[model samples]
Every structure is written in C-alpha cells, then in structure tokens.
Target: MIDATHDTNGTRYKLFSFMTHDVFGHGQYVKHALMENEGSECLTDAVTSFKYVNPTWEKVRVIIVEKGFGDISLL
Candidate 1:
C-alpha cells in the first residue's frame, strides 16, 4: 500500500508504507517503496519509521532519482 500527503508548498509527496512481520523467525521487515518528494520531510519520515522498527538492521544501499512524468509507471 501507499500513503501520500501534500506539503506546505502544495507539492505532492508519496511514501510506501507496508510491513511484514515474522518473515524469518520473528524478524520484521518494512518496505519503503517509491518516494516522490526527494529531500523532503516525507522521505525522512519513511526512513525514520523503517529504522524505528528494527534499529539493529543495517542499511544495505540507497538510490535516489529525480521526480518525473509518472510515478505509477515506475512501479
């Protein structure tokens, strides 16, 4: 699933909010999919929430791309 909100500047921000629990022996996984507003608070919130779930988990990698014509198409 996805959640979206508009910022003070009326720019639309998208966040991927979903969780999977007990995937592998009580391990919890959170997936933050596509984010529209890069460098915005929304992205920070997404990363924060993911870390909050499992603080010990290390970040494997990260990739940032500029917003474009259609987000859904990227999905």
Candidate 2:
C-alpha cells in the first residue's frame, strides 16, 4: 500500500502486497497447477481478497535484491 500519511513526517511509502499458496509443496512433490505461476492465477484463485494496487507516490526502480532491503533508484 502506498500511503502519504502512514507516518507523521508526511512521507510517502509503498508496499507491494502479494500472496502465495502451495497445496502440496514447492519441491518435486508440488504440482504445476498449484504453484504460483502467474499473477492472474493467484488473484483469481484466492479464497478472499482480489488483487490490490496502491497509488503511486514516487516511482522507483529496483536495482538489486538481497535478504532484506536492497539498492534502488528513484525515478
């Protein structure tokens, strides 16, 4: 969720929210139909809550990914 007022500083924040489901598992036993293959499948098969998109505040381009937060560049 992108929010302009979640903090007292009046700064904008973005949260890319998504969900995952694995009926069998993510290993050899997992079925291809049950894995998270596409965005539409997840949004359509979820028990509740459809896809959500938060408003854009400041655009950013992800440069790197790590265990935690990684490098990014403002657009």
Candidate 3:
C-alpha cells in the first residue's frame, strides 16, 4: 500500500501487484497498473476482477508501494 499527502489532494492505492504478459514468439513482458482510491475492496473488486476477466494473465506477487498519494491499504 502507498499513501501520500499533497497540497491539492491526497491519493491512495491499494493492493498493488505485478503481472507478466507472454507474447507468442516475442517473449514475456512485465505488465502492471496501479489503481488509486476506492478503498480496500479495490483489490477484490478491481484487481481480482482483472484476474477473472483475463484468464490468460499469470498470477504475480503483490507489489509494495513505497511512494504515492493519500492513504492506501493492502488487501
């Protein structure tokens, strides 16, 4: 989880993770995206949703966010 405070607004990201996408002949590439706000459920609702939606994606370990905005939590 990552949390940061800013003058304008604070942002929070929860359940950060990394995944790999394999291209037939080109080899495998690391793919990941961070979703901020939305609270703890973001993992179950958003992160896990991707896993269910994209069956081809391999499970990657959860990422440790060292820097970000607002208050975030790992699910």
Candidate 4:
C-alpha cells in the first residue's frame, strides 16, 4: 500500500506500507524476487519485474477527484 498526499503548500509526502513487511519477515520473499532480476535499474524496474512474476499483484487505486484551487474571495 502507498499513501501520498499534497497539501496547500504544495508539499507532497509518500509513505510505503512495505516497510512494515520488511520490519517483519514477509518482505523476505519480495526481496528475493527482486534479486532474481540482476539488472533492475530502480524501484520502477523492480516493480515491473515483480508484476511480471505475479500479474495479479494488488496495487493502490488512485483517482484525482479534484485539482486546482477555486476562486479566492477577499473581504
């Protein structure tokens, strides 16, 4: 799971759920799978390789519901 948010100040932050699995033992399997692909360039490459192994991997669904600020009213 991934959680990302952008505030009014345009500061964006992201949290990765896999860290918890890593702290435990669940991520060991994932780590091994990533290692199988020796030439992975970055996180995206690892993710792509993982997707190749398990096509049904669960991914967070994000929808941009609203964007941009509305008209500002000054008193």
Q: Which candidate is the best by lDDT?
A: 1
Report each candidate's C-alpha RMSD, comma-separated, in the order given.
8.3, 17.9, 7.0, 14.1
lDDT of model 1, residue 26: 63
Candidate 1 wrong stretches, greater than 4 Å: 1-29, 32-39, 59-75
Cα lDDT tens digits for candidate 2, 1-75: 111112333333322233222346332211112323224444244212322231331232222223332212211
The best candidate by TM-score is 1
Instruction: List the candidates' TM-scores in order.
Output: 0.34, 0.17, 0.33, 0.28
* Better by TM-score, candidate 3 or 1: 1
How many collisions per candidate? 0, 0, 4, 0
Residue 64 of model 3 has an lDDT of: 44
How many clashing pairs does model 4 include? Answer: 0
- Comparison by TM-score, 1 against 2, better one: 1
lDDT of 1 by residue, 1-75 (tens): 234433634445454554443546462435654566645455566666666776754543333333542243332
Q: What is the model-wide C-alpha lDDT for candidate 3?
A: 0.43
Off by over 4 Å in 2: 1-10, 24-75
lDDT of 4 by residue, 1-75 (tens): 221123423322221112214435463333222222222243345455656765545542331212331211210
